[model samples]
Target chain A: MHGYTANKDDILKRLRRIEGQVRGLQRLVDEDTYCIDVLTQVSATTKALQSFGLTMLEDHLYSCVADAIAEGGDGARDKVQEASQAIARMVRT
Target chain B: MHGYTANKDDILKRLRRIEGQVRGLQRLVDEDTYCIDVLTQVSATTKALQSFGLTMLEDHLYSCVADAIAEGGDGARDKVQEASQAIARMVRT
Candidate 1:
């Protein structure tokens, strides 16, 4: 089992906000809002999404990765390796 | 000012462990260690670092971005915009 479990409701709530922000940006584009204004809203939405991603990743590390490392088994070893490669991919982008 | 600020020491501590893990992988490669074992370590390190990135990103959202959105000013707006672009760029990769 993946050790990290996200509260579905909270995830939805954050995501909903981001969605709204994105829609607002779309509206701004439709209405010909100032470039700076649209960009600002875009920034807010992106940061929010990134924040959500961060929380999930953090939980995975503390709950899953750390636990796997402590247990010291083949399964644990495999999980740790999987996590490392996944992160390297994340950073490389 | 960027609303999110990192605890430098903690970041360094996490990074140091990652550094050690990477070095281990290097050794494994040179010595022609088991591929599976090396890949496993790589996965763990990647996840750990990704977790760190997530924490920083999350903090930036709750601490800085949220505050900026609430305040409602030119500066706040600009910051929000900056965050959005950064995040979008992040997702694209």
Candidate 2:
């Protein structure tokens, strides 16, 4: 099974909520809501995405990375590198 | 200025569209859309996020990484690592 298969439903639900938040954000922009207010929504949305990304990362580590490491050798190295790169990306975000 | 600041508006626009797509996916689930159909929408949403991620990565590379490299030494090394990790994460996704 895919790494995210276990939490697929939860992930979708969260993304759905984030989707609503994004729509609200668009409405804020459309109505010319306060600059700071819009920014606040943007911040929230960004955080939501970050949170979702982290959860996905956790799933990947536990499932895919764990599987790769079990296989050993190049598989292990690749998985570690993959995890490291993911961390790096997340930090930048 | 932040790396993404240059393309902030465009990025926002793209995110807004993706946000709508996410909502549509939610609707698909809520209305009991077909399983494969919902899965298809899910795939699209994932791709949208990935595309957004890549664009953000590009912006980071051009601005933040460029700045770090210009600074030289540790800064460059850190930035290179940062970029590599990001690419790894993207590939996994």
Candidate 3:
């Protein structure tokens, strides 16, 4: 099982909410809503996704990375590297 | 009409694509995909959403905000302030 497996339901719930937000954005656009209003919604949606990513990242560190570190092998270093790369990608986004 | 009026189709298309990406994330989690893989997809989705937000913001600046500025009144100042606040929100996200 993956690090997020335990929180799968929570992760899916967040994604579903984000999906709904995106759909709302489309509705606003279809109705010719003001640009600033739409942009505000976009920011809210992005924040939600960012929050979700942080939760997942924290879980990965606590579960997967911790396991690797406890095992005392090169896998610990590799996992840390992989997590850092994921973080970099997140930051760039 | 709003700043995004002309690009309504494009904006809606981007939102639809984002919605699809969010759904894909749900699928990945439900299927027990690896944590890093899911996180990677999350980053991609965030980037797409940010790109969409930037396009909408640019349109607002070129159209609504610009129109207000061209008119040269208190409204122009208000519009600029509003847009700046939106940008701040986006940056925070």
lDDT of 1 by residue, A6-77 (tens): 354554455456545545645654554543454355445545544555565566677667777798888788
| Candidate with the larger DockQ of 1 and 3 | 3
**lDDT of each residue in A1-93, candidate 3, tens digit only:** 878888778888888989999999999999998999998999999999999999999999999999999997899999999999999999998
Top TM-score model: 3
Q: Which order, best to worst by TM-score?
A: 3, 2, 1
For candidate 3 chain A, the 10 contiguous residues with the lowest summed lDDT are A2-11
Model 2, residue A69: C-alpha shift (Å): 0.8
Model 1 segments beyond 4 Å from truth?
Answer: A1-6, B1-93
| Model 1 chain B: worst 10 consecutive residues (lDDT sum) | B1-10
lDDT of 1 at B34: 39
Give residue B87's lDDT in candidate 1 (0 to 100). Answer: 59
Tell me the TM-score for chain B of model 1.
Answer: 0.73
The C-alpha TM-scores of every prediction are 0.45, 0.55, 0.98
Ranking 2 against 3 by TM-score, winner: 3
For all candidates in order, the CA lDDT equals 0.54, 0.66, 0.92
Give the least accurate 10-residue stretch of model 1 chain A, judged by summed lDDT: A1-10
Alpha carbon deviation, residue B32, candidate 1 (Å): 39
* Models sorted by DockQ, best on top: 3, 2, 1
Q: Any runs in candidate 3 off by more than 4 Å, and if so which? A: none
Write down the RMSD of all candidates, one decimal each. 15.2, 11.1, 0.8
* Residue B1, candidate 1: C-alpha displacement in angstroms: 32
